[model samples]
Target: MSGPRMTVVFATRDRATLLPRVLDRFAELQSPPGGWSLVVVDNGSRDRTVEVLRSYTDRLPLTALSCPQPGKNRALNAALQHLQGDLAVFTDDDVLPEPDWLVRLRAAADSHPEADLFGGTVLPDWPQPKPDWLCERAVEFSVLYAQQRRPSGACGFADIFGPNMAVRSAIFAAGTRFAEHVGPDDTNPLYAMGSETELLRRLEGAGHRGWFEASACVRHIIRPEQMEERWILNRAFRYGVGEGRHYAGRRSVGLLVRRLVYGIAARGSALLPPSPRRLRIRYRDRWLAGVAAGRPAARASPPSG
Candidate 1:
């Protein structure tokens, strides 16, 4: 907290190929005064990831932790214990950042020392000739927060991608640990049904600050697998589950009604005569997923190695 301004914490399952590019981006940061570090949290990878990580030997500040468990929070917790930064910058293995990411994040944190949480824009990385599907996906992702002039939950949606978010070191140092039981675990919320959003909410409750910035941008890799219809439906449903979990104690008739309305509205949107033929099916599947209230947390882990 006294010397260096920030540290980079990269968590991955089996992203050996993508690690270097991400590291290289950070290495290119412009005129950074503070000593920043990168932590690679291996969440149970069997591939040549460890070997590939070894390739970064010259990037001496790098540290690696092997978390055999496949859950995101489990691996993140393991890596978090090993970190000692005033700021912990978290980005997914699949995403690549602009060189100034750290500078902007550090500046954002310094500008608002009181806020315990920090969030930034996560624009999608569409293929050079962006596909129609990717365009729809972009709208879906952005509409969730395009209205947020500041950090608050009143927008009927509150979310942040783990791939492009940062949190104060004290959030971890101050014993504000993430939920080990859920989140990044079996399609679960890490902090007992709270997503990163819920964690920020807690930070807010505890009088921690959260701010939004345009400068901290990362292009998330919307992989081919994620483009599948079933995949997005699953994502939409899990979103409901996470949101439902976070607002557990406060659920009321009004809230339930609002959700019901959402369900109907989504169904109506899917029914729109002009909606894309391919995406409508996707929307239909999503509505069904929402109606089903999402499947129970999957015991299955992402294919590793």
Candidate 2:
């Protein structure tokens, strides 16, 4: 594809003060060799987020849309409705990218015609005196946007993260649609998983490929509340359920062993010595592996003769 006309679309609920910092980062992006644009979606905030967003009308073409129904995908689909680009990059307001973030995305899009979706690393803004729990189990949530190169078989899931990922605008011609099958809310009538995770699966199911680019980067702000162990586990559990909804049907036997090991390990990490930063990596992987196995297999162990 010709170097696509691109736009960055961000979604958020609150964090009025925090959102501006990220917006500032987006505003700072330089022109790509082909050019790109930006937009934001407000997912229902009672705070001063709207007032703050209004200040941007003078600096860039930033339109703020209010979406109260919730779900990141809904906000995303709403934002998607406003853009006229060939590529629409979806990120969260909490992530601050380098000055060249958009520029790099355009470059990647320009270079790879086969790449329908793309993502990059999210370096953490670790707090001073980073809490042990954060360095331990907390990094899991913090590093949701962390960078990695995915194996070819699973590039879609490996490169997926709602806070720092992008897709071609052509895919959203229908509106800000979420899979009635998956996304962030188990309680949601439309929830089967998360937007990014489900979207990647759809792209692959539809025969498109998404990949990670080492140079496309973003830095995510780690909120203090996210530093809590309980909060981290809550996020992990939700991630587990989300992963379960997707990868759990095939690969049943392999998933069974891993889920049991992780369930015990997650419980053990909570009781025995505090979890380590390294274990944080295992948290998502374990859940995704077990989840890739699904509810039934996740509930059972591999049978031995």
Whose TM-score is greatest here? 2
In candidate 2, which residue pairs get closer than 3 Å at backbone N, Cα or C atoms, i.e. clash?
77-176, 182-192, 182-193, 183-193, 183-194, 247-292, 248-292, 248-293, 248-294
Highest lDDT model number: 2
TM-scores for all predictions? 0.76, 0.77
Candidate 2 structure quality by residue, lDDT tens digits, 153-209? 225655666666778777778543666444543244322345576767777788878
Residue 145 of candidate 1: its Cα lDDT? 21
The C-alpha lDDT values of all candidates are: 0.60, 0.64
